[model samples]
Target: MTRSHALFILMLSTALPQMALAQAPEAQSGDADILVTGRAEKLYRATDTEIGRGSSDPLDIPQSVQVITSELIRDQGARDITDLYRNVAGISASQYATVTYRGFRQDGNFYDGMRGDPFQGFAVPSLFSIERVEFLKGPVGMLYGASAPGGMINYVTKKPQDEFAASLRGIVGNYDRYGGSGEITGPIDKDGVLTGRAGAFYEHVGTVQRNSDTSSLVLDGGLGVKIGPDTKMTVQLTRYEQDLAGRLRGIPIDEDGNFLADRTWNHLEPSDYMKLNGTVAQMRLDHKASDALSFNLSSRWFRYKEDQDYHEPRPVSDTDGDGVPDTVTREFRRQHRNIEGVTIAANMIAHVQTGPLRHTIAAGGDWYWQQSLFDGVSTRAGVPPLSLTNPVYGLVPVGGYDLSNGSVERSDTRSHRYGLYAQDQIDWGRFTLVGGVRQDWFDDADPVTNTAKTSGKRTSWRTGGIYKPMQRVSLYASYSQSFEPQDPSRQSASVGGPFAPVASRQVEIGAKGELLGGKLQPTIALYRIVRRGIVQVDPDLAPINGVDQMSPIGEVTSKGIELTLAADITRDWVLTANYAYNDARITDSAPGAAIDNSVGGRFPNAPDHQAGFWTRYQIPAIDAAFAFGGQYVSGQLARSGAHMKGFTVFDGSVTKGLGFADLMIRIENIFDKTYATSAFDARRGAFVGRARTVFAELRVNL
Candidate 1:
């Protein structure tokens, strides 16, 4: 064998024991009976096993749900939650992100199924201590007040484990970007019931775009206590900071809508705008009341501030007759509003069996409140000469005339939301029935205008069933309804005042099967979703799309099929794959718009074809493994040709464990694919996604 192959095999042999010990596989009995063992265990379906009868298993709730496990994250070598979602199933997302569910994009994200909002426009979840990502599709109104119909994604953080363990990991990759992260989890007491886990990460990210770069620092820590009985409690803290410099650049398109020839880094020499910075602080608490009940509460505080210099030619129609040049400079400044929020929730389950009938009832209630306070000042950058006559270019600058220093008003507002929900599962013979109902209420303390601060109340429900005629096959279907509040963040007075509430309905039918001695699991589903009373900006209030207008647009519908498969073909080989086919379109609009244009056109950012697969093989003799995976998304149009277009990308990784540390090498966009991460303005087309890049990491455990 070649020297490299021999070395790889040698490394694998030495790492086997450690790899096997990282996680204990699902046990048929014993400690596995506990419900809150690990976040991933509650979310991920390791095989074809159906999570029946409990609210803890979100999947059994009859709503669309996607879970990205810690194993998947490790294999993919993802640094952030964004990278993880790129490969998730039945989900399409934009770069200008919002915390949301399903394919509907919202800006609100959560932690451990609790509330987490953007602080200073940069609150993307950092994966420093994350365990798994759960995308709960549809309105989670029962658990989170005022949620978007699109749903919400909750990052379940990694908590303290029963055993003593420690790991230190480092990465170096493209753009001169480098980072290191570490974690330690173990018992703080002799009983091993009280445990602590701490982790931290920092990185200097290079921007391929000229005059642009991002560097970040993050710290996370947590402690968990197991009480004498069945109760447990946890407390955690997180702090993060990011800085962006240069001209936050994006791919430019030609008049014909063709991508610019320049895809390589550094094509534009930034002319005006300068630097930006963002920081955030978050804290959380999780408590389990008993084996059948639990409660969670969390809070976060965020602040953002920015300054920029805008330069351009003076507004002179050759008035000065200076044909050569008439350059003038304007300074721009922004003080971010502060965002703070508190969330509290409870969940419970009641299970009983009588004869051949089994019944499990799950119920819960939640309340969430958040407030945004704006306070800051923006004025001319420097003192301008008091004179306006004989306007000399450099001699005396005009004070108030400097558009750069214009001051904007700031304010404070609070919103309150609450929800109560219940679900039941009934089993008879080989058939199972699931049904649920939820009531949601949303109230705004600051209505902006005398528009009579409105209160929205809605009842959402779902019913579904599964049939297993055979030991290896099952058939299932479900119909669910959800309603969401308008975008409160970007709400203009008119839209938020008179606009109708948006409601969504979904119908799905599917079948799941296990083949080859339960070694392979496959699922096929077909679903249709319709949204009504969609909210959109009132023409009169269109204050620069994507920037100031956070109002709703009309209505839309999306239909598609999802296919997923996972298997262990052999004892040492594992495979996973998923595919989605979506047809999303705007259904209705206001006024002089074209006929089918508003009702039948494609929805922006929803790709027609999306698929992914990953396979891994372990050579038992050597403690080493090899894995490969990639995703493909077909071209898609944003806002019906308003701007976005179709694109695709692929990613891959490889890893080895030395005697003392594990080494991982990853290639993102392995084909060097080019595509849009997001595009807000059709006028600007699509903001290109990341380019082909590579990274390597070495991790040591103590």
Candidate 2:
């Protein structure tokens, strides 16, 4: 065997004993259940989660809910949501800054259990102030209303603590990347009734793409007040900004899915840039009316603005005798957009009992509103064709063309949504039953035309049950429904009215168990989902002289099985593993559907098989930890007609503690694999994954 493989096996052997000891009952009961320690947390299992509502055990949820704890995020050196995909099953990042979960493209992301618009030109939120990320797979419409049938992601923000604590950290990585962050939390009053926390981070990073750089700043703060013995309130504020210079698009590829340009090639002018800025303010109130009853309310206001002047390169012709492209053109686009949104939600929870049954009931309602404005201009310009054998740079001037002469488009839209939902959980001996229902109302308007564009209403529901024959083992089955509203702008004029909301249904069965005397948690799930009523052009109408008609005639189905395991094994040993098999297909569609209908076409960016494994071992004698992990994704279609080859990537890290501080070094893409992370279109281009890189970080606690 190779030397590296032999070394890895040797290290695994040395860590086996610790893993065995952690599975013992005595070790499991010792400190494995402790929720948090200092700024870090033990990885294995979480006691409770806030995914469906206020609180519930993961085993009791009857569905797949994956939690990415802060401790794991720190160990992985994750910067944004995209960095956590390896820990989540059946999910992948796609082109256009989107994510595909299960088989569908996620429409939006949630913050602290509240819905938010992620397409408002803002980059993914920083993880500096986040406590954990929860991925709830399957239809959650009974509680969250309209959403993607595949699932939704919720980011839980950190709250103020009563105890005093402070920390500072600095990070430096290859490609001229550097950043610093700090946080402080403490009691603000002598009586300890008031607490506050603040954190900020700044980073300037160079991208693998040529002539591209990004700078970002994030600030978060929160204040908590104990108004009375039974009442408490908290307020939080977040501000973020990001600037991107040069270009940030993928490299073009040939029809055979081969890279046509260098990995770091750029076709953008020097003046091309994109900037995003946003701010959010939130308030929450919690009150205990009685020992068995409680109430909570939360409200948030957010605003984001973005400006962009960008250019795209498109292959035009091949002048040379060779088959490779020799000429390219550019498209310049300018955009200015602004968005304002608000949300208010409230819920009440009560613990009650009926004859021979114990019950936990929750009722809630939420209202949301948003307004957005978009102005854009675009033009196509020709550039001098450069030789493929040896390319030259800086041949085109920046912003040399007049933007006023380009084609212009503008839009102003406003929308409102409200939902009411109730859930009841009943327990009897070894059986638990859950039932929920929700009603949602939505409306949209065009202020510029002073007209109501569309209005709709939907009702969703869920039912599930869990049976626990053993203390640590639970089996569950659930059925759920969800809805998604189509944009009025996309509706054909011949349709006579806005298209109706699409609907989705899901059926899932799963088993959860704590094995090895509770030190290891394993979950297995199988699910099938169907979505219908997709809007498509009415081929029968044949676009009569270019005025097309539309109809709802598309359908899709996704079925999958997922298995995951998390183990603390021992005080100094941790491991996580997951695998998924997905079969997502376009079952039926009209002739004019957005995607081609081949009877059973696979979904883009959805791989049939994915798996990942991570493990860490700590040595007290050396005051250090060593960790390694790897991920694999099966080959899949990049777009309708193009295929992308699958690849495996490995990562490793080492950390050492120095009395008052900790230092860590991480190496990513250790093998320097050349792979596509995202794709524009089948024959157009694909985004390349980062090359082998190294990073170092130091953190001090005060």
Candidate 3:
């Protein structure tokens, strides 16, 4: 541990005991249920209202959605997307793990309905300028083209506020880590008609894995104008840069080939390194044509670049008699990737309200274009007979072929998508009905790297109903669909070797209710997803590990249940919890396949059980709050048949407000427990997991 990190932890521990003892009594119950314009809150009224960030009615969205609020982030001591996932049910993070919904891994991510996939392993979003994160479970292809059938995640950026407010915060944490964020939002003109907001944040973080660290900076700004009585316009831009210094860890399986023990902590030496840098920007406009009609349009552009190089130890051969094995060899590889994209969307909503009936209709269209280029170079040095004992580790640089040797390849791909969707919601007394349909056209064009192209059309629809059983009670159920064309980069045989496009579909049903004095909101959902024809290079033709190149040839099915609960049991106490159960299996297999897996066997890295919960208490007299929470995931199988046991982790945080400033402190892995987020290389017992850590901050708000 560095001297600075040691000191920070020491100071925090020294002050906590005394502060807690001197704090005033906790606030009474019922005070925390204040009605607020939260993102999740807006989702429920999707059909009737134009969603700027999120809807006013979250429940009526027809999908299993979970909102990670700004408050949850603060209370959980979260610093990044990885941290956020720790307490979000149904989500798991393994370096080799794929995005999953209902136990099935999905594709990348989305931001405000736009694509947010990282080409060369770089898709973590900064939370410093976020208001909330919405996790929409199930297929979202209808709304977001090329999305994974598993699900989609949307990050809600903070917007301009009507009130004048500014805050600055700084923190020092364990492992020589420190960071801070500053934010300002207010009206630029009187009458609160025009508002603006700007925020900046920076962080220097360290990991338990030696030589693994991250330094990041972000700047966000936005302007909102109330053009007229019913029209509004907003423009937003964000820039971010991050430096990563870390040893990438792969998956690890036991001798029998299952995920290793849940609590195992085995990290490799710091001999590998990877880093990335990128930026994203967006703009939006909203206008109300009349008292019953409104329109929205938004556009986004993103650019990313990364530099990566790593060392690989391989076997070497020795001819002469040397006491030391035979020969030493090493391999080095460097990859550079550039990705850019733009998206445009326009939507309109019309509402009709009368004595006994209320109706809202919405229709919209969206378009997106994304292009990416990847270049790589690999070099090897040492004696060649290739023996296991004569390994490659210590070696000097040597002359190696450049791109001409086919060791390096460059490829660019463009994916374009257009979609039209319509939805309607009708309300009659205490009953409400909602339904929607979407048509999408996806086009992928690539002429440079061999010949690769795919054109596909998909249609998805959804319907649901909500009934208010009583003044404080309600029931809701919904069904929805999703789809995705073949990945643009998938390889093929005719022009190249043998790979084709893959497609997927999904079905869902769910219900939610609020009871116990309008304080507790809970939901239960069940869904099934089907995927057919996944493209792959023929292991024999392309010889990817001696396997022939192949086209999409099999079908997989995944089904699961989800439950969530969020409530303020009392004024001083609030609790949030969620659980997910998944059953994913492969229903079909390719002929002459190398591996014959079972239909009921668990999917790779998809845990069958997942849950998370958080609770907080407010001490009003002292202006302080305390929170405790964590997540649990069941064990999952490694790709190579290894079983990784399930594990549970915990975290906590506390904040106190002074006259003009507030101090916030948080501890991660409170139990100092050791566990692996992911691992690979069954031959070696190396796993990657974070150790215990602490963070503290001082903030000034005006």
Best by TM-score: 2
**Model 2 TM-score relative to the real fold:** 0.91
lDDT for 137 (candidate 1): 58
lDDT tens digits, residue span 393-473, model 3:
223332332424436667787888888888788889888888778888887777778556767787877677777777544
In terms of lDDT, model 3 sits at: 0.64
The most accurate candidate by lDDT is 2
Better of 2 and 3 by TM-score: 2
Candidate 2, overall lDDT?
A: 0.77
Alpha-carbon TM-score of each model against the true structure:
0.78, 0.91, 0.82
> What TM-score does prediction 3 earn?
0.82
**lDDT of candidate 1 over 1-702, digit per residue (tens):** 235533533443344345336533421123211112222222234322112223343323455556677777777787776776655677765654442134455576776655645432533456777777776555454345555665567777787877766666778988888867666676777777788876666777665544455666666667887765655667676655555553243343433334443444332223323333334444444455555455544454444444443221111122346452122222333455456667666666666677988877767776777776655444545633211123333333333345444677666667787788887888897788888788888866564432245567888877888788776666878887777665444334533444445778778888776666656767777878778765554455565545434334566777778887777756667777888887766667644343222313554555677788877766645656677777776665544263445556666666665766677788777777666654433223345677777888887655
Can you tell me which runs of candidate 3 are displaced by over 4 Å?
Answer: 1-56, 96-98, 116-120, 191-193, 251-253, 256-273, 312-330, 353-357, 382-406, 471-474, 488-503, 535-553, 591-601, 680-687
What is the per-residue lDDT of model 2 for residues 393-439, given as tens digits with 9 covering 90 to 100?
55765456666678898878998889999999999999999999999
- How well does candidate 3 score on lDDT at residue 157? 76
Worst 10 residues of 1 by lDDT: 26-35
Query: Candidate 1, which segments miss by more than 4 Å at Cα?
Result: 1-61, 99-103, 118-120, 142-145, 246-249, 255-257, 264-333, 375-411, 445-452, 470-473, 487-500, 535-554, 593-600, 639-645, 682-685
Error of 1 at 470 (Å): 4.1
Ranking by lDDT: 2, 3, 1
